[model samples]
Target chain A: MTTLALPTTEEEIWRYSRIDELDLGAYSPQRCATQVVGDPAILVKSSGSNVLKHDDVFTQTNRDNSEAIVIRVPKSHAGGAVEIIHHFDTSGALYCPRVIIEAAENSEVSVVERFVSADGVKALVIPVLEVHAAQAARVSYLAVNELGATTWMIAHQEAEGERDSNLNLSVVALGGDYARVRTECRLIGQGASAQQVALYFADGTQMHDFRTTQEHVAPRTHSDLLFKGAVAGKSKSVYTGLIKIHPHARGSEAYQTNRNLTLSEGAWAESVPNLDIETNEVKCSHASTVGPIDDDQRFYLESRGIEPATAERLVVLGFFNEVLERLPNKVLATELYDRVVAKLAASETVGSE
Target chain B: MSVLEIRNLRASVAGKEILTGMNLTVRSGEVHAIMGPNGAGKSTFSAVLMGKRGYEVTSGSVELDGVDLLAMPTWQRAVAGLHLVMQYPTEVPGVHVDELIEQAWRTRGRSTTELADAVVAEAERINFDARLVQRAVNVDLSGGEKKRNETMQLALLKPKFAILDELDSGLDVDALRDCARRVEDATNEDSLGAIVVTHYARLLEDLKPDFVHILVKGRIVESGGPELADRLEADGYAAFSG
Candidate 1:
């Protein structure tokens, strides 16, 4: 049997990534239980066949050792949000959690997947999530990453929208020593639309990397993406996104925006946005920014009698508020906001010392 | 009464001297109008007083209530009762005015209930849109709305001294009168000392300054009663220019 080789940073897709530092030999396959909560009919442990593509070695490996779960929203049913929580407690373990969500025609559903690990655990987790929105259906998925400080996560997310369907994908990642997620959204049917929003914050030497693609394959399709992040301490973050319109996808519209704030001299952030159009009569734009907090914003809060550190905390929270406001779930948004605040408060303590 | 005194205040920006030996004194409940031509250090004076970065005060003494105002940080200066109504208030997206003011007030041990009441009261007093306090601070506010928002903040913060830097620059006839009236009421009711900086006589018609000083080449070259504003408005700053 031939050995499978891991990907390297030399590839364009992995540019500026920390994949070279990963050690696959140190980890062994282990099991982490998946707890399904809310709307029991919508989520189940099943042996459902996977329909999404295995684009890379990570997805293929996850499929080989998958703890698969299927979430199906019934036809014409409108239900509240369901949650899937995966808790990892073993040390030096490799765990792969796979999820497949399908919304029937005219159905509406929301799902939140949370990955959490025990403190001080050293492990590697690969999570694969596939979302399929049927004709005229609505699906909203939020993935929250709260892994341990010593854990590493490589996540793959694939979403597809059918005729007249709507899809929303949101990510709030503030955990793991090194976490990377690659999200791809495809609009395959006419009048299908998708919106993706994310808020990621890194501190205390942590790193978060995101790569996203918005592909329009049919006429009159639309997609919008907004991702914002903040880096403090010696932490770092990287975001690269692309908008692609196919040859026959005329009258398509796509917008991508990524903004980052580097809160410390040692922290770093990089944003790269690109657009490709194979057809005319399409509107597409991409914008990205990586910089320190605005001095004017800092002064504005400080002049209002807010202490410098407190002023910074407020500004950072305000920076993330844009994403929070756009979140589809208010309860989840509040929880995500609290996590960001905790991270900022932790970094503030480190800064004052 | 509290006093904000600037003695021989010489300041510079980008290594070039702007305010060369400027002096002024404003007491609580008193109004002082500072008129100057373009580049005569009108805005620089306000910036330096608020401890804004990049504005260097070479050799001068500024005392707020007999304390070394220059020795404190910008926020500390605000806590010590000094505020500048910025000419162009910064646009802070995603932060609401109510949240900002509430945070500022709560940090000083004030209750949120008081802030809520004060926000509504002040907004009404200044004819500001009460709903705007719920929106992002100055994000999409028009020029007139921005000035009104600043005026509302001035009333709520209640600083011991404020420098209205070109408060009338962007206001229409109606907005200018309304803002001037609100400020005048603040001065009379709260004893809020102010330094009204303007180039036109229209705003002074309602502000009614106690002293009008002509600032030329950084220093107050001439000082007189309210009539001085009329003379400068009629004769322009060309009389005092080099």
Candidate 2:
């Protein structure tokens, strides 16, 4: 089996990212042996017909890859959140684990995938998720990346939306050494819709980069993307999104928006939104904004007797709530909100000094 | 007896003074109306009372039952029994109206079951459709709908001291009357007082206030009984300015 070489800075995708800081030579790809410990509330196994058994994409990719894990969700199950915890205890190398989710027609499901390492373990992890939303199905996906401070992570999500299906994906990044995420979704059938939302907070010289694409190839399709993030402590984030509407995809509506809040003078954010629309009847727009939090909104919350820290948390939560609340599951929405708040609180405590 | 007392309260925004030495006393069970021309600092007074940031408090003090209001943050002030129905209520997109109202209620120490029941009953009293509770706060709402939503919040919160900043603006006559009636019904003899800020005197016709003060150039230029609204309607701010 041929091993896949780690990407270098010379690659276009890794240009602005700090890929050189990752020393893969010192580590070897090893399967996680630690007993994953977390409540079902925080982690759970997926239940459904194992679609990965018949056509496992990760099996084919893992021959030379270092990480491989399979998750299967069958059709027509009452949608609920499934949490998977990836624990890295010892310092070593890890390959991308493939997660596969299949939603049947009229079924609804939500999953929260969390990547966390053992305290102080300097590790490398690569994770990939593939989601298939069947015709008329609904799926909500959330990923929380909270690896060890010294660890490096590379993640990707590839999704396909079927006819009249609905797909929603959200990512929250709060830890890692150098993290990169590539998310892509294709609307392959008429009346399918996809929504992408992400929130990332980086600090302590860490770097986060995200690349996303929403390709609309079917007529009457819809897609919307909203990713908001904050950077502090000299950390940096780069977000690039593309919305493609094919020539025959008339009557389609698509929008892409990226908003970043920089809290420190040295913190930086780069946003690039691209649109390729070939149909005149389609309604499409892309917008990106990178700046500090709205002083007015912050002050408004503060004036309500909320302390500065509490006010900032509320504002940040509110900022992301614009997307979080859109999730179909109230329980999942509240859970995500609380987790994001906890992350913000943790950062504030660390930065207080 | 006085729930809120404002003495010589002066404020500014972007270096321009808006409220200059404004003095007012609101006792429990009293409804006061501050009617004035455009740019008379009516909204500015409400903003300052709520501790809206960026509005520099140059001088004077505002007290809620003798607690220095300027020292309190907006949410604390809210928790201290102060609620403001903004002239232009801001939209909190993707936030359900019920969730916000419930949060405010819970923050004020109401039990979850009690809050839910109270919210549902109050929402019904204001003729709010049950479906609206699930919608984003003030998103895609009409002028009258926004005003009613503010009243819904006031009913749910039931604060001791309330400020209605231009709450009568942009309402049709029926909606205006409905809003005024709701305000009258909501404010009672129980340690509850309100300061209604508006430019139109017609709103006061249905729910007569105990006192009327004409504000001009950041100061109370005229003070009188409910008749002051009628007098101003005939002569306008011309009689009170300067």
Most DockQ-accurate candidate: 1
Clashes of 1: 0
Q: Please give, for residues A151-204, the per-residue lDDT of candidate 2 as tens digits.
A: 878776788888999999888787887787888888988999999988787887
True contacts kept of 1: 0.66
User: For model 1, how does the per-residue alpha-carbon lDDT over B1-242 read when each residue is reduced to its tens digit?
Assistant: 89999999999899999999988999999999999888889999988998889999998899998999999889999888888888888998888899999887866667778788888988887778899999889999988888899999888888889899999977887777878888888888889899998877778998999999989889999999999888887788888775
Give per-residue CA lDDT, model 2, range B122-187, as digits (tens).
777777765787777677888888888788778777778889888878877776777777788767
Q: Which 10 residues in a row give candidate 2 chain A its minimum summed lDDT? A: A49-58
> What total of clashing residue pairs does each candidate reach?
0, 11
Candidate 1 clash pair list: none
Whole-model Cα lDDT of every candidate shown, in order: 0.88, 0.76
Candidate 2: Cα lDDT at B183: 81
Candidate number achieving the greatest lDDT relative to the actual structure? 1
Q: How does model 2 fare in lDDT?
A: 0.76
Which runs in model 2 stand beyond 4 Å of their true positions? A1-12, A32-63, A66-86, A99-114, A129-146, A160-174, A188-192, A201-206, A231-235, A261-268, A291-309, A326-337, B64-67, B79-81, B93-113, B129-136
